[model samples]
Target: MVSSSSDPLATRHSTVSRENVREEDALKVLSAYLADDMRACNQAIIDRMQSSVPLIPQLGAHLVAAGGKRLRPLLTLASARLCGYQPSAEQQRHVGLAACVEFIHTATLLHDDVVDESTLRRGMASANALFGNKSSVLVGDFLFARSFQLMTADGSLKVMAILSEASATIAEGEVLQMSTQNDLSTPIERYLEVIHGKTAALFAAACRVGAVVAEQSEKEELALEAYGTNLGMAFQLVDDALDYAADQQVLGKTIGDDLREGKITLPVLAAYDAGTEEERVFWKRVIEDNEQTDADLPRALDIIARTDAIKTTLKRAERYAHKAAEALEVFPDSELKALLVKTVLYTVNRVN
Candidate 1:
């Protein structure tokens, strides 16, 4: 057994990795580590998103140009490399598979903005905002169809099953969230289930497929799956917290954006549960009743601060991040393994 004492992944995870951990640093390191494989994935994504319909590629290019981290596809590529997948350049299908993950993720983003009536994505005008909702929704469907084609080309029944299930689960999660929207009474458990379906299911599937291609043991596959799930949970929880607490300049998103959308995040739930009766009334007005005013944001922030809602939400995120790190214990420590562990820590601690 590799002793955890000497392993940097385990050691830093137990100590400094949890402090001053920047998301950008992890992105840079991971980008460097997977440089070659990532190029292939990028090229594949570019090639596959092309459509004879000018509007399809035009809109797809806009989204691809907007450029978030591409974290899901990176997870797929990294997981495969960690599992010793070293196919010859000609045999490299990890690129196609990773591209497929990105397509699904991109499709969901397009669909989500429409559902949320969002105007901005990554600090720029959203696809729907620029292209119109009808165009955005149709292009999103186009991306989904493209993703399925990528999956079929791979010709792996197991991979098809995993990605398809994740796609369906994402749709179901969005529906579940709609039912709970603007209801301060939404159970924390139900909220968790929603994130698991909408966000983490794809993360889990993305990681698992990498292992599947490498023909790793079931034990190893599950470990990576667990890692992805918990990382995703932590990622989403931190995102919720950030919407209330993060620096606007760094993340290119404004505080209180999610609250304005009637998102019932952990901080909102905590404040609702811990607040005085009068505070409850305020929450109902702004969030539940959807009667928010310009002054309401400052008031909401004050209430959340008083109740330690942001802090509490972040603490909850920490628990999930720790679990994600622990899930990697089955893999012997390598640079990739250590970076993966660090990525888990970054998920929870990120300011942006």
Candidate 2:
């Protein structure tokens, strides 16, 4: 979602400092750094997504064409490059592994849209909204199955075990989120746990597999995994903040979709924890009881505005972003490594 603006990751208040690399232009930076690798990985995605069943490819292509940042797969490529994985003609295991990571991410997205009952994705009609929940769910399962095929083709027991465990953790995170819905008293620790599994687990695995494909030392593998984990945390934390504050057109979803669905995020928790007695009662009614009216959103916004919840959440995201940067210290100084650090900055700084 790069804009015409020079600093694409700029927010309403300020622009990201671009002293090292202008990683603000995500599409451009990714293209410049990992162009061929990404093209191969995308082809692998297209090749593997094909099915005798027309609807499978049709539905899969719809979302793929919608143009997400493709950050997860890109992480695979970046990590592989960081670990000095040169693709030989006979073996481009990193490409297939990257595609596998994307499939896992896309499957989760399809399942998530159905579970959220979301009407839109990336500003377009969601697969579930267009293709029906049954189709979305089945295609998601299909994608999950396809990912296993790719992993098996790679013939690495460790990679398979890592991704399989991540998949299970993702499902567990989704179930935990469902259970926590409409509960304002959900602990911040529980919220972090949910995100660690739902979002960060796959990121960690995606990064780890790149090092595995590179046959890198265990230290490099662990370092990349930590980087991806911290970056994922920052990314999702910013996403939750955007749900409360981003412009509708830029965010591509309703600003208060989480609240409308009775999902508790840090903003809601901040407001609830800091508000007056009457304000707490409102939160109990709107979030806990799932009783909401048209006016409730504005009231919730006001509370958030007063409590500075979005800022607090963004501050927490910055902490994770810093950790992500710190994790990359294991890698030597190089353009790719600098870009990786900039990616961390972009995660927390991005307006979209």
The deviation in Å at residue 63 for candidate 1 is 1.0
Residue 291 accuracy (lDDT) in model 1: 95
Clash totals for all models, in order? 0, 0
Give candidate 1's TM-score.
0.93
What would the per-residue lDDT of candidate 1 be over residues 1-352, giving only the tens digit for each residue? 1112321222223222535444436655787789998888888988988988999989988987998888999999999999999877576867889999999999999999998888778888899989999988998898999999999998899999989999999999989988989998899999999889889999999999999999999998999899999988888988888888766765677678888989888989999999999999999999988998999988988998999998888788888888888999998889999888778766765642
List where candidate 1 sits over 4 angstroms from the true fold.
1-23
Q: Evaluate all candidate structures by whole-model CA lDDT and list the values in order.
A: 0.85, 0.87
Per lDDT, the best of the predicted structures is 2
